[model samples]
Target: MLDNLPLLLNGFSLAVSPYNIMLMMVGVFLGILVGVLPGLGAPNGVTLLMPLTFGMNPVSAIILLTSMYWGALYGGSTTSILFNIPGEPSSVATTFDGHPMAKAGRATEALTTAFVASGFGALFGVVVVTILSSWATRFALRFSPVEYFSVFMLAFGSFVAFGGGSPIKALVSLGLGFSWASIGMDTVSGSMRLTYGFNELSRGINLLVVVIGLYGIAELCQTMQASPGTVQPVATRLSPREVLRAVLAMPRYWIALLRSACIGVWMGITPGGPTAATFMSYGVGRRFSKAGARFGTGEPQGLVSSETADQAAGSAAMLPMLALGLPSSATAAVLLGGLMIWGLTPGPALFAERPDFVWGLIASMYVSNAVCVIMALTTVPLFAAVLRAPFNITGPLIVIVCLVGAWTVGSNRTDIAMVLAFGAVGYFMSRLDYPVAPLVLAMVLGDRTEDAFRQSMILAKGSIWIFWSNPLAGTIITVALLCFALPGFTALWRLARRQFLPPPVASGR
Candidate 1:
């Protein structure tokens, strides 16, 4: 550990450089600007900026992009608190108490509390990243193709079993993602399988294009088609002294903050993203809050718990990206692009060869997070001004961003078309009790799943029993498969049993 000091310091130096600092500030500013808007979200904003990085230095490029991601995290809370609209899915949790608090005439307090919560949560995330990165590196090194395959299978299984919906619909989404994943030039046979006749099809579907289009562009289209909701401004003020007092109001909340952060970190360490963390934390917060009844009506605990978890998840999401070359979110997906542009490959080689890149990025997270807090405090008035923008004007701007974000991925016009097409699909999915996260997760992990299974097969030399022959591989596969299949099996048994059973008597009767 002592021998690693020099490299750690080098990373700090690079991350703290004037140019990188400026990039962080710029990213945070842009992130907030978009986040505070009505329809724009973090992923769309991050995706739109990726194309411009093609000509920049990788480190600077990364600093800027990551800063934006952090900024959006901060930014989303503003809308949730002020207008009851979550610019990002993660911020939906924030709306329960944040918007209600505003409606109850504690606008300034809720906003400030949210800001502090985001920073505090982010702080916990940085500490986790700083302390656990090395351990993560060690663990990631043990992941062979079999391990990765099992991991993806386990993750997808968890989603399917837990995702509340028709099993057929969920499976359809998963299979579609796998099919779309197969469209690229075959990684093994070098044969084109699904490209139809287009030359771009041979180069295959770009993950960024698919994700950004599906998540962002589609979301915006749905928003545009729907009736705009009520979004009135709240006028309130809280002094520094008052804000500090507000933060200290619930000493117990600090415990909640820590708890939420842990939940977020755990989710990110797995394949889950901030949305997963947000929902999980929200559930825990609901169960634990002393004033639980006031949560969706107006309570600071609801806001604090949700925001804290989201930041923690976002922060921890970086671990797998840095340690194992796995990206758990769309922002991480963009960061993956930045890593490639920087001429760095993520894997065991990274830990051995580029400790500075790893440490510098990790250390920079501390600086950038602190910077976010201070900047937000000083710039509260500025963010508040975002409320001044009329919805009529902001709506078009968000749409423009969505379109551009959709087009930026691969410069493919088909991707642009898919954005609107998928937007309707996404909106309807939302209406039908289907989940988008599982679909996106499937799309992201599909290729990796194929690669792992293929490699494991090749290693086994066409022997079907090879997976079972290795004890470790066998156990992981068995667990993953069981995790995936058990819920449906249980559901089927319940359905069959229900056929012979009579309905229960009414409670009153």
Candidate 2:
């Protein structure tokens, strides 16, 4: 680590140059906009801007793109907090506690905690990239189909067990999501499964459309039904004292912050990416925190866990893309393409040939994290002001934004209609006390999980024991099984004890 100081300094010098700094700032601002608004996400934002980087130096182009990535991660929380809508799939975890905090008139606190935690997580990811790139890349490559499948199962099992709802209901929601995900053409055989003879259905439902309809339009419908007349505003201003206090409180949750960062980094290096990291961290944090029982009900710990992991994974994803020529997430894949377009080869070879480029990208991440935090904090008043407006006025704006977001994907009108349908489904699910998180999460992981399981089975020549053939895969599978079984075991134990225990004496009566 000590031997890399001069290279680090050179990287920092390049990142801090006037042109690069300005580019970083612009990227952050646009990224935040894209993140807060519906439809456009980090991948879309980066791809839209990729053409503009054609004539620029690779270092400058990457700094701008990566900064935008960080900014979008930060910006996603804004909409999740202010409204029930999550601008990105990862931000869905943020909505578990963030919007409730907003409704409780603690929007300022929620936003502050999310932004600060995101900065810490992103900075940690960047530092880890600089110091452990080689080792981490190698470690990530060790995850095979069985291990990946076990991990995905663990994620689903965790939600079913500790999602603070009826386990049966969670399972039902999970199954529903999987069913919805199966609507597209089959990847293995190229045969359509549930398209129902419609050409649009053959293409399958887009997750972004589902998210926008379920959260945005469905939320508006609920608001309209709940408060038929005048819509009131919540408090949105934060005092300087409050700001300092929130900043000071950061140390109290350092353990959660650090744990979330680690989880994020792991997911970022592997195939799970930021969305999975946020959900997994949030679920684990809920089970571990003493305030676990209050998760999804305006708990600050949930916000911290979700936002921290979300940003951390976003940053860590760059490591595998740059060091291994592997894209860990959708956004990273777009960046990977950009890297190729610039006549630069990714992987270990890039490091040997262009040390300055690699290190410069690493150093610039540090600067971007700082810049994003500052920009988000300073703009708190502006976002909070949106919460000040009456729901009637802001409601339509959100709907319009949701429509715009839906229109951006393939310019398909069918998607807009699907959004409305899912909005209705979401509203009914809420009314029925079903956990939407599981549904959304399962939808996100369904295709990947199925593919992994099938691939594992094929590799094992149809043997079911392949999941347990390797020690690593076996251990993870065992843990995942235990997570699901613990609840049932406890219930049975209580029933047996009740049956064996003697009746109470008359004195008890």
Candidate 3:
């Protein structure tokens, strides 16, 4: 233990170095900024700068990337609380009460709750990753291709179950994303797909361009469809009395933190990201709160629960990368890619070879968490000021940034076109009531899903039975199948309930 402490301490040294600490601060700052912006997220933020990080040292590169990751998550709650728009999917839960808190003139209190909870959750996640990483890796390694494929299936199934929209639309969006994911050359046949016959076709769609197009440009265009307006952020300063009370006032909130942390830890290791964790934590918070009656309407607990889970999930996602050598989320994937770019091989060997790097990252989580809170507390008023900007100005700027971000990804004009195409598609699909989450999830998982299926077939010597042959694989498949059937059952139940209950007459009507 003492020996390990020295290694961890060494990691702390690097993490706290002026450059690294500054990077982490920047990451938090960016996280907050991006989180405040609608339609942008950690994935897009990371991919937006692939070219820059490609040449940097792994350690410094990681510090910058990780900090950005943290910052993006931090910024998300600002949108949720101020405008009722979730800056990221993970912030969806925040909408439950964060917006209302602003509406009720308790915006400062809500922001404070969100910041503190995020720090607490991040701290918890760091501890989990530090102590249980080896165990987590061992468990992850037990999954074979068949099992892995089933897990993907489960993720999709669960997505549809909880999407709260039309299943066909969700499937369509997901299929589109998966099709896009297939754009690169096929591994076995080396055949190009969906490339439209350009030389750039061989490289496939750049995800950064896709994200910029789908979220940023399309979102801007959609915003143009409406008359623009200015939104002044609700301004309220918390007094020392309120601060002391808010800090120690809630016992129930800690329970919410625990549950949110569980959601974060579970999803971080799986395909789930901060978005899923946010949604799950939100639902759970609503279900568990006795004050549920006040939910979605200025309840401090709502912001705490959603924001806490968001940061926790983001932080814990580092475990699979470090311990199992698997990159579970987009940011983690890029972090893995960055490690490769720096000539470092990750896996069990990485810990043995660069204990300081691994331990230092762990220590930095604590530092970053503290930094995020301190910064947020001092600057909540400033963030709220962004809401004061005229939508006409901000919308066009968002469009330009999206376009530039897309074009810059590969320094290719083709990427800009892709962004426009995706943005148009996103606009149409969104209007048609398609749930976009499945599509984004599919794009992220598509290649991996295909690889898993193919590997199982190869290992089984072309036997389709390989997908369901092993007991673990078979069970996972069976369970996933059951999970997939849930939406239909849910629909039927809702219908039954509606038929049985008569509508109450409105007082005015």
Candidate 4:
């Protein structure tokens, strides 16, 4: 870690240049707007602005883009808290309790806590990226096809097993996502399986379109049906005393903060990304907290858990992309494309050959985290006022944004239709109390899982034992199986204990 300090200093010098600093500020502002608006997220924001950076130096362009990513992560929680609408997929878990807190007249406290936690998480993740990235890159080199498959399997199993819903429903949702992900043309066989003769379907469904419909359109539908107003007006200001109390309470959950950051780093280095990390951290917080029974009922721990993990994972994802040339998330994939366009190849050689660009990107993340957190905290009351507007006004605006975003992403009329269909599906799923997150996560992981499994099978001549042929792969597969069975085993153990133990007799007073 210390050996990299000179490179980090050099990177900081580049990032702090006047032109780069101005670009970073602009990117942060735009990212917040994109994140606050429904259907626009980090990937879309970066993609929209990428062409503008083609004429700039590689370091400057990266500084701008990564700053935007940090701002988006911070901005997403605002909509989730005020409107029960997750502007980004990573913020979905925030809505579970953030909206509740806002309705209960604790909007200021909730927003403050989210920003503080996000800052802490981002700082930790950036430090990891700076110091331990080389080690992480080396570790990732040990992964082969079977090992990669096991890692993805572990993510899927952990999410479904601990998703806090009906196991059957979670499995069904995941299966449906897998089905949707499989609709695209197969790269290995060069044949389509589920396109059903539709040329558009041959390209498969876009996860971005699905996210917009499921969260944006479906939320508007539910808000309209459940109440006339989208959200109730509440006190959106925090006093000095109230702010101090909230800040003081944070230290009590230090264990949760540390644990969530670790989980986020692991997920980011692997393929789980911030969405999965947020849910996993929330689940862990719910199960481990003393107030476990009150998890989703305006719990502050829920906000901290989700926000910390989301920010940490979002920042940490850049590590693998920078060090190993592997994109851990969709946004990272877009950034990877940008890197190639700029004639920069990401790998171990990146550190030796282009330390300036790599360190500049890392330094920018640290700077952006501080800037965005302060910006988000100051603007909380302003955004909270949007909740006072009538749903009748906000609802149609949301639908229009969704339509425009979907249409413009690929310029395809079929994507607009797909959004509407998904919106209806999301509504019904919510009405049935089914978890929607697993479906989205499964869609993200499904294609990668299939590719890894197929590659492993081909290498092993169709022998399943290849997953256990090496110690590392075997251990990963073992852990994945355990994660899958843990919930069932715990249930069966409880049942057995109940059946064998005698009930306590009530004594008459």
Candidate 5:
């Protein structure tokens, strides 16, 4: 970690250039707009902008996207506090206390607390990434095809076990992603696999097109269906004095802040995603804080707990994506796709081959966090006004953007139709309560998973036992199996306990 300081410094020099800084500001502003608007979150915003990055340098493209993400996160809190709406799904927990505080005329305090806490959490997560990424990359250097396969299984298993959704639904999503990924010619054999002689599918489905459909178009449809008339934002003025007061008072809740940040880091690394991290941190805060009883009644700590965890998890998730080719969230999955599009492979080799890119991205996170905090605090009113735009106007515009983005991917008309098809699929999947992140992750990693498994099989002469041929591979596979089985085991245990335990006698009212 100490040895990497020089690289980090060099990264700062690269990130702080005039061009990069301009991009950062622009990305953050657009991201805030995306977050403030109904139906557009960080993932959707990033997906929408991906096409524009095709002509950009890979490093610049990544910095722009990541800065947008941080800004979107901060923007989400604005709506949660002022409009009783969560602009981003991860900000849902913020609404509990944030809205109440706004209603009580503490909007400025709630907004300030949320942004500052989020900044702190993001910085904490970035620090952890800086220290852990090098070690993780080194550890991954020892992995072979068998180990890689096991690692992929572990990622899939962890998603199923801890994804905070139904295991069957998650598995089904994975299957769908893998099926879509298999569409087109096989790279190793140079033979068609899933294309049913459709000339359009010979090149396979584009990841960008799918993402535009799933996140952009699909979300617009849902938003239109669930339009809630005009939003009346809370009236509040943020003064420098109030901002300073909120920042100073944050130290009082240091324990909660630290605890939530740690939870965010752990969840981000393990694929629980920021949405889960926020709720988990909020729940834990409510359970343990002395003001637990007042949690939903305008407690400032509630905002801190949820907002901090949301940003922390978001920042920490980059580690797995960069070091091990594992994306812990939907946005990370999209970024992984961007890396591949730029001819960059994510893994230990990436660090060795392109330390500049890796460290530059890491350093940019620090700079972006500070930029987001300042932007969010100063521009709350501007973003709040944006929410007043009717969905009828914004909805159609979003659809056009999605279509245009899809069309540009290969200038193929078929891509537009595919986007519509996937849009329907995504909408229905959301209605059925199916998790989309797992599917997205699977799609991004599916081809690699298959290649690794095939290589492992070849090495073992078609023996299935090859996964367990060595201690490292065996251990990883074992852990993956345990992760996959954990939910079932817990359910069975609960069922057994319910059947065997005696019921308590009813008390008289």
Candidate 6:
């Protein structure tokens, strides 16, 4: 790590150039706009900018794309906090407490906490990448199909065990998500399994469309149902002072911050992705925090956990993309393609050959993230003001935004209808006390998990022992099993105490 210091310093010098700094600002602003709008997430935003980068230098192009990515991440939390909509899939967990906090008239604090925590997580991830680039490349190479499957299972198990809801309900949600994920043609068989003769279903449901309906449209439905007429604005005070206070209070949750950053880094390096990292971190934080019981009720720790994990995973993902030619997240995948388009190859050789480019990108991460925090902070008042708008106006605007966003996903009208249908499902699910997090998690990762499992099985020739044949895979599977059984074990322990141990005696005196 120390040997790379001079290179890192050189990278910083390159990143801080006036031209690169201007690109960072432009990328961040555009990214924030994309993130604030539902469905136009980081992946889409990066893809949209690819064509424009052809004329730019590789370093400049990457700086623009990565800076935009960081901005979008911060921007996504904006809508999640002020409204119940998640601008990005990863921001879903942020909505759990962020929206509630906004409803309680603490929008400024929620936004501040989210942006700051995200910045911290991103910096932490960059530090990890700086220190562990070579080590991470070697570690990532050891993962086989079996290990990948184990990792996915661990994510699901964490949700079931640590998610503060009925395990049965979480399972049911997971089942639905997996079922939805399986709708498209099977890759191996090339057979349509769930289309039911509908040509539109052949393409499969777009996850973004589903998310728009489930969170954006669903929230709209709930809002309209709860209040028929114009609803009064939520009382909120947005100021630099409030933001400062939130920043100052962050140290109190250092435990959550560190734990979530670790989870994010692990998930990023291991293919769990930013979306999964956010949900898993939220679940783990809920289970471990002193105020665990209050997680969903406007808890700052929940926001911190989810946001921190999200940025951490996103940043750490760059390591694998740069070192191993593996993109852990969709945005990273797009960026990887951009690298190829620029006539650069990924892997260990690229690092040695293009130390300036590699280290410059790393240094840009630090500079851009710091810039993003400041830029996002300055925009809080503007975003928070949206909450002060009467529901009569904002309600229609939100619905329009949801429909528009859904329509853009595939340029198919079918997605708009799907969003509406999912909206109804989301509304009813919320009324029924079902957790949406598991469903989203399943949908995002379900297809990949299935593919890994199938590949593992094929390699094993139908034997189940492949998962245990290696120490790493075996340990991961074992941990997953423990997570899966934790809730049941807790229930049994409580039951045993009720049956054998005496209740607290009434102390009359």
For model 5, the local distance difference test gives 0.89
Q: Is candidate 4 or candidate 5 better by TM-score?
A: 5
For residue 199, give model 2's deviation from the true position in Å. 1.7
What are the TM-scores, per candidate, against the unseen true structure?
0.89, 0.65, 0.86, 0.76, 0.96, 0.68
Candidate 6 error regions (>4 Å): 2-118, 225-364, 502-509
Q: What TM value does model 3 have?
A: 0.86
TM-score for predicted model 5 compared with the true structure: 0.96
Better of 3 and 5 by lDDT: 5
- Superior by lDDT: candidate 2 or candidate 6: 6
The candidate that wins on TM-score is 5
lDDT (10s digit) by residue, model 2, range 399-426: 7777776776558999888888988998
Model 2: pairs clashing at backbone N, Cα or C within 3 Å? none
Residue 204 lDDT (model 5):
87
Reference-based lDDT, residue 508, model 1:
71
Per-residue lDDT tens digits of candidate 3, residues 1-509? Answer: 34456666788888888888887887777767766765566666765655576676667677777877877777777777777777776778887888888788777677778877888889888888877755654566677777778877876776666566787676787798799889979866788877788787789775556666666666566656643563445655656666556667555587877888888878776656677788778778788877666777778877777788888888888886776445555566656655655677666667767776677778888788888887766666676676566766766676776767776667788787888888888888776788666776677668778988888888998987776887877876877677678777878898987788865664575
**How many clashes show up per model?**
0, 0, 10, 0, 0, 0
| Model 2: residues with Cα > 4 Å off, grouped in runs | 1-118, 129-133, 225-365, 494-509
Candidate 6 residue 214 C-alpha distance from true site, Å: 1.9
Computed on alpha carbons, the lDDT of every model, listed in order, comes to 0.75, 0.79, 0.73, 0.78, 0.89, 0.83
Candidate 2 overall Cα lDDT vs. reference? 0.79
On a 0 to 100 scale, what is the lDDT of residue 411 in model 5? Answer: 86
For model 2 the local lDDT of residue 16 reads: 92
How do the residues 1-509 of candidate 1 rate in per-residue lDDT, one tens digit apiece? 45556766787888999888988898888888767765556666777788777787766777788888888888888777876778787888899889889888887778778877888888888778777777777777877887777767776776666555675677777776778778877878889988788776777666566655566656655666664645566764557876777767746577778888899888776767787788889888889867676778888888888888898889888888887666666567557655765688877678778776777777778778877766765665677776665656776676677778767656778877767766667667766766666666666567767888899888878776766676766786787788678777998889987777765764575
Quality of model 6 by C-alpha lDDT: 0.83
Model 5 segments beyond 4 Å from truth?
501-509
Give the C-alpha miss distance for residue 504 in model 2, angstroms.
Answer: 11
The 10-residue segment of model 1 with minimum total lDDT is 227-236
